[model samples]
Target: MRRIAGVFLAVASVLGAQPRKPIQDVRIDILSTMLTGNAGLGEWGFAAVVEADGRRILFDTGARPETVLRNAEELRIDLSGITDVILSHNHGDHTGGLLTLRRELGRRKQSAISKAYVGAGAFWQRSETSVLAAAKNAYESGGGTFTEVASAREIFPGAWLTGPVKRVHAEKNYGGTGKVRNAEGLWVEDNLPEDMSLVLETTKGLVVVAGCGHAGIVNILEQARREISKAPVHAAIGGWHLFAATDEHLDWTASKLKEFGVENFLGAHCTGIEAVYRIRQRAGLTRRTCATGAVGGGFTLKDGLRPGTLAK
Candidate 1:
């Protein structure tokens, strides 16, 4: 009996010591952005279909449902397969495609999106009833539900939502010109508390996906490190919201990102082309470090070219 107990303990220890298997590959199909390699479908928004671990996830919905759907058809991406939807923020540009996505699901008579993961502040619109009303309406229309993330939580085995990143660093740049409602129902300047990021733990490191990135880029990365995972950030794709950044702000951001040792970076949507150029030129970032994010561009991180290399 003593020997058997010892053997069971050994087996338990071995099983506990084994690390979880990392995700094999992540395929990002960009549906909308500022520019397009495919003709006629371009919008000033961001949305991507992420395929990994046998799950099809929609990162954002772009600025317009029509544009996103059109691009999805052109890319031959079956919207009926998306099981999860992660909304980075509550802006119309990011949530625009919910209605259209709902419509598509209704037409197919199939359940594509099961749940939409959103931040706490997602439903808090300045003066409006609720910015998330659109999302709620769509979900109800399709027999879906909304999962509000107040803190860091993992929706999947290795996928996490860096729930509400804290702005610990310098606040030189005033996020964006958006607002949220107060508890008393008054509109106040939005600090974008609902801004969250998606972190995918992989063999190499963490692959972070941001929408708008209203919570400074550095803050988002730091939150990922502090709250979610300790692994180094291997690659980051999405908007940084540096459209109105000054030369100094841009330089500082680039230098900080370099310090963080981020190997791959792809900025788009609100990251302003001029901001990208400045980061590459003055901030000492290489073209490879400062990747392209044209519309309708699909980026396959593993089993293909690195992030931002699939620019058309």
Candidate 2:
């Protein structure tokens, strides 16, 4: 009887420890941006289409639905294929495309997207009523349902959200002046506690995609490292919000990211070109580590996440 129980326990353990499938490829297409290398589609916003593990995830939909839709048309990207949409924060550049995405979903007459992930404060009227209204209308008018992420959790086998990153570093500041309505029905300064990042686990490590690093890049990275695996981060793509940062801050950020084993830093939108350049010029970033993202360009990681020089 003891042996029988032991055997059953062993079988249960084996069944519980399912082997994780390796992600074959992770392709990220820059759908919209303020700085463009391909030209003709430049807009003051940020958006990208990420394809990984047979899942098409749209991260942040630029500043406006029209801009994103127009750019998507130019890039030949079908928004209908997006199975999930993740908004990093409640900022305009990130949430502006919600209405348009909803409209497009209506036009296609299909809800292919399993869900739209967002932080808890994503629907709050931080700056104005229009943004939150757009989000609500989009979701209610047959758009994919909005799943609010309050804590770190894996939405897919290899995909996750760094929900409400804990602020560890003292120097990291929440720089946005936006305001949100509090419980008392009075609008107050919004510290953007709902800022989050999308993390993808790959063979090499974690790839973090953020809308705007309002939670501070350092804090975001730390949360991602802790939530994902102990494996080193392969890349960090998106706005770092270092436009107003001082030289000391940029240097410190670069050093810390390197120490954390982040190899690639693709800065766009609010990252500030100068800050990215400084990061590239650092001691270890010689191999295509720093570059401004192009609007129509894409990045592909095949097989294991090996270190090959990424195309600039």
Candidate 3:
């Protein structure tokens, strides 16, 4: 019965192709300070390093290449060791230092090469006004490879980039001084262009690394669950874009995340103090500050929380 055998094989293939269960051994390194200048007020940028299956993937080069480089040097994070670089979105603060980083890594002896990953629309999103175009051009000119994805894709085994999360919640009224304006002189609404987040299938649960959460942290979490089938969110570290969030918005986000069993949260950069406090007040959350000048100040997926060692 060749026909019957073919049907059975097709069904097996469909089930096997489903997204695999959770993954483990994911680590995120905060390479730069959360705030650029002062303790509370400063431009925000973050560098996230993800380690999965013995490969190093860098996500988002901070606002300043020097800062990222210096932090990497101090942390002993070898830039030459990085294999992939993922830009979350096309903002200057996220991609400003990419050029410098590429140059530095290219000079290494081992020549640990890096490929740039981003959303397809990132290139055409008002490139003149945004630094994304510059970053892309620099990487391409440097002989580095580039890849574009329209939606979530698995970059490594059990490691996924949740591309362009759909904003399901009603838009919240939030404004800030660092808002980006388009060529029309209008503040771009939260049309986050396929903002990506890293999802690591951990033995404990899923570890989510967010750049700015412009795609909405709740949306990221929901998509992660749908992708991996409700695996516990072990930890979420990076900018939450909560500085401008209303109290109601903050409360709702906190309530929603609580149900997902997020155990550790390292709030930094755009996550306002008030929002951090709200998240800390919730049960099962341990808060750690990820400010600038905080060398050796990162958490490990295997070792758990690590406090900020920045000098006062």
RMSD of 1: 3.3
> Compared with the true structure, what per-residue lDDT tens digits does model 3 show for residues 1-312?
999998998998888865565555665667754543222223468676777757788888888756676667666778787768888877777887787887877788324446888865565544246777766666776787778777778887778888767677744322333443544656565365557788887778888887777777888889888865478887777777877877777778777878888887776667666777776675335444222223345567677655454421
Of candidates 3 and 1, the better by lDDT: 1
Alpha-carbon lDDT, every model: 0.75, 0.74, 0.68
Worst 10-residue lDDT window, candidate 2: 302-311
- C-alpha-based local distance difference test score of model 1: 0.75
Root-mean-square deviation of candidate 2: 3.5
lDDT of model 2 at residue 123? 63
Shift of residue 122 alpha carbon in model 3, Å: 1.3
Cα displacement (angstroms), candidate 2, residue 49, comes to: 0.5
After superposing candidate 1 on the true structure, give the runs of residues whose Cα lies further than 4 Å from its correct spot.
Answer: 1-18, 128-131, 170-178, 182-187, 281-285, 303-312
Write out the backbone clash pairs for model 3.
23-201, 23-202, 24-201, 24-202, 33-292, 34-292
Q: All candidates: CA RMSD in angstroms?
A: 3.3, 3.5, 4.7
lDDT of model 2 at position 311: 32
The residue ranges of model 2 lying beyond 4 angstroms of the native Cα positions read 1-15, 112-114, 124-130, 171-174, 181-188, 303-311
